[model samples]
Target: MQKKILLSYIVIILLAVGISATTFWNTGYNYIEDENNEHYIRQAELIANAFELTRFDSANDFSSFTKSYADKYNTRITVIDLDGEVLSDSEVEEQLENHGDREEVLDALRGEKASVTRYSETLGTDYFYYAIPVASESFTGVLRIATPFHEISNFNNSVKYSIIRAIIVCVIIAFLAAF
Candidate 1:
């Protein structure tokens, strides 16, 4: 009976250790993903701010201006006035209501770096947005850039798959050692 109790306790301890280790590794993966997202947001905001600073104002239409800028920068760019009016977009000029209401746009209009993520109903996927303020002599506005979240999602999924593979390997090793 004492030997049976000892074996049971040993098994419980090993199981608890395995569970704790898996939990710890999963937490680390989440931290890495969060950091990657933050890095991307900062980079996008910086790109938007730089574009806003050097944007040409002499163009008759801001759409053309945005297109040219996007071509040059290899990223999407949108300029919005203080009131959330879309002044320029690299893609389309459709009447988008209250652009400033978005957290990133609002922060940019208020002279701060801001970022947000959301699911796009039209695109059927998630997206990330980064924005910063455009300061000029006369007017203050916002410059926003966006990228699809698929890139990050892919990376995260790869990481998760690797973690699972590692756990399976670990379990196999443990079983072999026990045997």
Candidate 2:
């Protein structure tokens, strides 16, 4: 009888830990995604609204202007003309093919803002993209910003791991105390 009771207690503790870990991971991941998405959207809007090819006195300065933002935010920014041609890109050196077909670009071209979270084939990592159509007279284009998903994902995972470890330690302590 004592053997069965002890076994049952162990199983219950294990089950509790399993449930807690799963819940912690899911909630943490979702929260990270949401918070970062909002950040990207706000940044895209700010950039698109303030963007101008001549902001630096000439079109030649566009790269430097964008490079600063990209470096500061740790994001990739690409300026796309109405025809989908990439005018300036923070990541790619060579001109990229027409982006009019991309979902986010298409949405911006259609005169509406759009965003998506997906895996980037070029970067080989997941990212959250937010795009907005430029309204400045200096340029009529779309500003697209991509925020890497890995950092948030990895941080959340580390949080989950730490929480799971803590729970295991607590369970062990409680079990020992019961004896």
Candidate 3:
């Protein structure tokens, strides 16, 4: 009877640990994703405002500007015209293929802000993208910023590990109490 009770307690504690770990991971990842996505959207918006204030219309000038801003934000920035043609890019030295086929660019062309996480074939890793439409009296376009998913993934892992450690400590204490 004592053995049975101990086994049952162990099982219950294991189940609790597993459930709590899963919940912590999922919740942490989603929360981080949402927070960073919105923050990047606002970053794009602020850059768009800066573009509006500037008189630099040359593609080279725009590229340099975006490169500097991308460095400041620690993310890649790409400016695309309404037709999805890449006008400027912080990461790409050469011109990129038309972005019209991209979902975020398409959504922005349709006047909606878009955020997404997807694996980039070119980068060989997952990335989070946020696109914001830029409009001014003289020019209009889309500004996109991308950051690697690993940044947020690392944060999620840290949070989950912290919770898992707490759960382990609690389980140990409870098992001792069971005696």
Candidate 4:
């Protein structure tokens, strides 16, 4: 009877620890991703506002302006006109294809805030992209900001590893207490 009671208590404790760890693992990843999304949205809006205030003489001028902001933020920035033409890219020097068909760009062109994570063929890397519509006196289009997806993945993986370690510690503690 005593052994049965002890075993039940150990099971309960282990179950509790497992549940808590699972919750933390999920919540941590969501919180990190949300924070990253918010950060990029705010940055994109700010850049769009700033862009509305300036008039670029040519694509080179536009690229120069975006390059400065990209360097400052350590992210890529691209401007796409209403017709889907790539007006300027902070990182790309050559003429690029139209972005009209991209889901995020389409959403932004329709005056909606948009975000997506995907592989970029041009940059040869995965990125988290955030875009917003911009309408200035001289320019009207979408301004997009992107950061490498690895950054967010690294943070999420760190959280997952920490949770796994915690679970292992808890299991060991539970076993010791059971004995």
Best by lDDT: 4
Ranking by lDDT: 4, 3, 2, 1
Residue-level lDDT tens digits of model 3 in 1-179: 99999899888988987897778678877887778777877887887788777776577778888998999888888889898998888877877889898888899989998988998776789988888888766568888888888987787678778877888898889889877
Model 4, range 26-77, lDDT digits (tens) per residue?
7877888899889888988888888888887777778887899999888899
Question: Which ranges of candidate 3 are over 4 A from the true structure?
Answer: none
CA lDDT of 88 in candidate 2?
78
- Model 1, 45-125: lDDT tens digits are 565555545635553346775787677656567778888987776765575556867878877777788878887553577
Off by over 4 Å in 1: 1-17, 58-75, 91-95, 136-139
TM value for model 4: 0.86
Clashing pairs in 2: none
- Give all candidates' CA lDDT scores: 0.71, 0.79, 0.83, 0.89
- Candidate RMSDs in Å, in order, are 3.8, 2.4, 2.3, 2.2
How displaced is residue 140 in candidate 4, in Å?
1.2
Better of 2 and 4 by lDDT: 4
Best by TM-score: 4
Model 2, 1-179: lDDT tens digits are 88888888888887877797779778877887777778778877777655753454455566775787788777899888789988778987776778899999999999889998889877799988888888565668788999787876777678778887898897888689656
lDDT of 1 at 163: 75
